[model samples]
Target: MIEYCLTVLGFVLAIVGRMDNLRGFVVLPKRWIVERFFAHLMRSRRLVRDFERSTTSAEAMIYWSMTMLMTRRLARQPPRRG
Candidate 1:
């Protein structure tokens, strides 16, 4: 039991050590991601304002809107006959 716990602890530490270090000033990840999502939302008039009465519904709507946009985009591609 002791050996197993030590091995697992070491493995966890090794994985943590290899993770990316955010040391420099840069555009925060959430801001960029949310901005792109909002851009997609702007394309839909219904998403322009908060129509959903609840936060959960608002989030669900965002996911639904993005998925719809992605499906339309994928559908627009012409298939190769070859």
Candidate 2:
């Protein structure tokens, strides 16, 4: 049902499944990237709580948080010689 809704909204959903009979502490592909991004988002004070009254407002906060993260990463990189 959720997948159908997402498809209707033009979003492709990819489900990452766990390996069968896997050992303990196994890391799945692309999962860590999502986890790391959410960790970074949690660092923003505005995102720490559910203060937004609307979904749009919450999405805006996420965008703002990601922009800040990207800018900080860019600032730390050395300038490229042209």
Candidate 3:
């Protein structure tokens, strides 16, 4: 169902399966990146709850949250000496 929906929207969905043979606390490739991104989004108060009435509004909020996160990280970096 998910694959069909994404495919209709012109997206290619890649399923990242878990490694059953791995021991405790194993990080799957490309999965942690998604987890970390969601963790960052959770920091934003607006996103913590479903406040947006429309999907467009929610998407805009997510973009705004990511922008804020990136700008803050960039601000902390030292200036490059050219």
**Cα lDDT of all candidates, in order?**
0.74, 0.90, 0.91
Q: Write one digit per residue (lDDT tens) for candidate 2, span 6-43.
A: 87886777777888898889877699998898899899
All candidates: TM-score:
0.49, 0.76, 0.78
Best by TM-score: 3
lDDT of 1 at 51: 89
Residue 73 lDDT, candidate 1, scale 0-100: 92
lDDT of 1 by residue, 44-63 (tens): 77688878899998888888
Supply candidate 2's per-residue lDDT for 38.
86
Quote the lDDT for 24 in model 2: 85
**lDDT per residue as tens, model 3, 1-82:** 6778687887777777878888899887688899999999999999999999999999999999999999999889698899
**What TM value does model 2 have?**
0.76
List where candidate 1 sits over 4 angstroms from the true fold.
Answer: 1-34, 79-82
Among residues 3 or more apart in sequence or in different chains, the pairs in candidate 2 whose N, CA or C atoms overlap within 3 Å are none
- Segments of candidate 3 deviating more than 4 angstroms: 1-7, 79-82
